[model samples]
Target: MVNRVATYPYTTSMIAENMRLQVKYSEINTQISSGLKSQNYKGISSDTQYLLSVESAVDRLEAYNTNTNIVLANVNTMYEALGQIEDMANSMLTAVTAALGGGQVPTAVTANQASNALDETQSVLNMKIGNRYVFAGTNIDTPPVDLTDPAWVPQTSPSVVNSSYYQGNSTITSVQSSESHVINYGVLASDPAFEQLFRAYNLVLNNSGSITELTEASGLIRSAIDGIANVRSNLSINAKSMEDQIYQNEQDKVYLKELTSNIKETDIPSASVQITEIQTQMEAAYSSSVRILNLNLHDYL
Candidate 1:
């Protein structure tokens, strides 16, 4: 009988190789199933800070998007209200023009129309969105205009007219459109355009028996209409700017998400191939281990 002194070493080598193959197989299998390079930052230690920075940028852009949406809502609402006020001004202008052409003073009909327009304009300027008044500037909770306030005395001259009816402050609202851009987009009830409108309407209401005053009111209404048009133009520009920013934010978010995926997610097809290769290696190792274990000096003899 021959003594096989190297049999133990061969068996030990095979056992060690099998253990390595088993561990590799399990790792690849888990990787394939989970579809992530690593579940935690520690798994992708080198990219942890970069990933956090990208995610933070995405969060900031999301915040800007949310804020811009609110500003756009307020701007659009103000635009619509201004349109209604423009219509009211045109109606009052028409009434005043008729009185002027007929060589007569403004009657009760013109005065009542002026009064109704004043009331309606007050309601429009005091418009609120989600409990905050749109035209109130920084005084978001307070009504911006109150023509019915007894303390709001009417001005007699267009040159001296101001937003006496405005109860809001001069603080302008601003929005962060993006990382590099901030937009000052607030329109207060005290804006000169609104002031002109109120002046024209009040002129008609307070001087219904005076032809000269009615003619002056007609010109004032025309100026107010032009001023309101300019305000609408500026607001429309702001709306467009915010809309463009929102679109850019959406596209940026998509790019950031793709970056996140690249940093954290595994390539499924590549992982599958690796798992198949490991499985083959494991099978071969198991077979070799069995052969080593079954080795006998008698069989060789």
Candidate 2:
């Protein structure tokens, strides 16, 4: 006679094993569907702090890039305006030089040219970009040059000095290009070069009858030209430096994004394979449970 072997214990063990397999299968499926190792920071516990820091860095860089672009635009605008003013100064110098050589001042021509230059220079200094006068220093809403004001006087000291025509303060425009850098790009209407330019124009307009005065004005114009050239050169250098910083910020952002992806993203292909293997194992377990449940003492005998 064959002894009875109870199949209850075996069947119960198989069910428990299948339940465990089901849980594992579900987890792999979730990972595959979500394409993330975890839904929250707690899932990526060890790297969560580092990821936060990197993300914060990216945010800071983005802010810097935005602010830098605005500063760069203003800088370029100032550079262009300065270029026009410099050309005007050169033309004035040439005209004065010609008159000095001929020993005959074309008073009307000189006056007309000076008048036009003065008008244009005033407009440029009072230039507005989106309702803000770029040359107004910290006074964004006010125009920096107001030659129509009776109180405005051309300096007589024959030295480079701030223009009395300027309505703005002495504040310089600047921006934070990066964590370690602050870029100053302000070119105010009250700059010494601008002062000299206005002085030269007035000298030509108001004192064209005196050859001595005209000669003094010519010297001032030359000095103004040199000063403007220096300003433009410095602006060009600052623009290049800002561009480089922007590029570096973008590259750093890319790197940080890649790092975040590595920490947060799941390996979909690997998880898919795991799910397939778990499904196969569950199927085998089910098959074994069925077979073992059907076993009987008579059959064994």
What's the CA error at residue 8 for candidate 1, in Å? 6.2
In candidate 2, stretches whose alpha carbon ends up further than 4 angstroms from where it belongs are 1-16, 103-105, 149-151, 154-162, 295-301
Candidate 2, residues 80-127, lDDT tens digits: the string is: 989999988999898888767765667888778888889998988889
Computed on alpha carbons, the lDDT of every model, listed in order, comes to 0.84, 0.84
Compute the lDDT for candidate 1.
0.84
TM-score of each: 0.90, 0.86
- Writing each residue's lDDT as its tens digit, candidate 1 over 1-301 gives 2226756676677778888888877776777778888878998899999999999999999999999998898889889988999998898888888877775644888889889998998898889888989788889989999876776676564436656678889998889989998887888889887887787778878887677677778888899899989989989998999999899999999999999999988888988888888888888888877766666767868
**Model 2 compared with the native: what TM-score?**
0.86
User: Whose TM-score is greatest here?
Assistant: 1
